[model samples]
Target: MNKLGRKLSLSISLAVIVIFSISILLTQYFLPKYYLHKTKERLEQVSNEIKKMDKTTFIHSKETIENKYGITIVYEPINSNVDELNEVVFSQLYKKRITLNKFWITEETLQKLAEGKKVNKIYDQGKLKSSFFASFMQRDDMLVLVGNSIVHFSDTAKIVNEFNLYMLLFSIILIIALVWILSKKITTPLKELKDVSKDISELKFETVHIKTNDEIE
Candidate 1:
């Protein structure tokens, strides 16, 4: 490749690298947060729908809700002790025995729920990486708990970065080919001019035919 082709290729490759680097950095910084926000919003919507259901409907539609939203639905008496709430909710949701500390529910969270506020949190402990969203709403004497576990997207981000890497490689190859062709087109006329000057210097005046249809010709 000529000097112009090499320069063009280098400049274009550097630009592509910079752009891809910024894109990957931005994705790493914001994608998880954005995903979490949307997941929480969806869970909140589901919780609202659950809040509107009567006890009979809620119970009857439990399977439908779980299957539709990929969530777990459980309810308990509003008068249940707040301290034991976490255990009850966790057991009902996961159907397993886990320490109370593993659950994200706390006194404050329970208080907010009692006040008819939605609760959302991230649970990342003991091989569990999930976004937990819940709301406690009264349906007669029962407090309906609508909750969901959303898996984190670290693997998805990894796949995206891998795809960007492949795109960068493909773009570099394309840039190199385009730059080579462009440089050759631009320099060909200049090479002919150089030869014409050399012939005139040697007193070899001849009819020179250059028909590039540009100033170089």
Candidate 2:
């Protein structure tokens, strides 16, 4: 309804907000995973390289790999120094603060890892998602677990959310301004016609004028 700017501004703003909100929601749901997938691919490559190293080299450089790539490394011994299921041998989270000390690794996963297998898992934390890619390799009496977490995506998701909020505010303001201008342009002739009718009814014979050439005029 172009009766006045208020209704028009409100309707247009709501419409634009619905569309933008859908877009932002979709982005929030999918974009982080897309980024995490890309990150997983890279992590897989690095894990593959680690799988090729001997047991000693892997244990010695576990910290270095964790530091260099900003991942968490955990070594689970199978044939050698067996740790309690809850005991973690080596870990470097790099400030990710992930509560996961034991990953999705199971006996089946360990068996596969012993044969130089790579595993990829996804962790969901409320609206946030993180990725884990690991390689399991057997070294004589030790099982080496090398992995990287795409927890950095949490920061990216936060940035995107903030950006979406700003964009929504901007869109509302812009749509309100445009709708106000358009509403004024559209209702001017009708408003003038109403005034002319009112004057004629009162027998105050004045020249009735409708400027637009449209049928309403």
Candidate 3:
């Protein structure tokens, strides 16, 4: 009911809101950036190791893009008489629902891959699966298709989303606790003022316990 009490409550609410907003913005920026850098480092490591394999191994063909996520090496050339592995692997990767970028190493794509040139990529978010199919031939007899899954990206996004959700929840709780503690402190001062004012008006100021601290007495 007191003016001091009203002012204190309003100030506390505003400060809490501002602090919470800053927390959300900072976490949103930093957490995702860190996660992306870490993921890129990992994928780069895998891809680089793959490049090494290309140099060392005697090729019946340039190695087909092996499905790296959950699928086992279904048929490495040494074990299988059927080089029909390309067709089978292609069908299975499509079914598993993990496709991000596809480079059909055509004469054009192979040229690009060989030259280490960046291909013009038109990413179709609507049909992400379209990114999965790139056809190639390592040798005349071997058809190599190098493709990736949307799962790698989707998993990254999911993890980042979960992380952001945790940040938001933590910020909310921290702001609430701060506001509660400050609100009580703010009320204590105003309530002191109120009681003092009331006692003065009622002419009981002489016996009033105006000071809260025993140490200050």
Candidates' C-alpha lDDT: 0.74, 0.65, 0.45
Model 3, 90-116: lDDT tens digits are: 454555554434422234544544455
What TM-score goes with each of the models? 0.71, 0.51, 0.42
True-structure lDDT of candidate 2? 0.65
Report lDDT (Cα) of residue 3, candidate 2. Answer: 53
The ten-residue window of minimal lDDT in model 3 covers 70-79
Q: What order do you get sorting by lDDT, best first?
A: 1, 2, 3
Error of 1 at 155 (Å): 5.7
Q: Tens digit of lDDT per residue, candidate 2, span 19-85?
A: 8778777677877668667667767766776767887788788778878877666655574323343
CA RMSD of all predictions = 4.3, 7.5, 8.3
Clashes per candidate, residues 3 or more apart or on different chains: 0, 0, 4
Candidate maximizing TM-score? 1
Error of 2 at 89 (Å): 3.5
Q: List, residue by residue over 82-130, the lDDT tens digit for candidate 1.
A: 6676566767767722222355557776577667666666565535554
Which ranges of candidate 3 are over 4 A from the true structure? Answer: 1-41, 53-103, 116-147, 151-185, 189-217
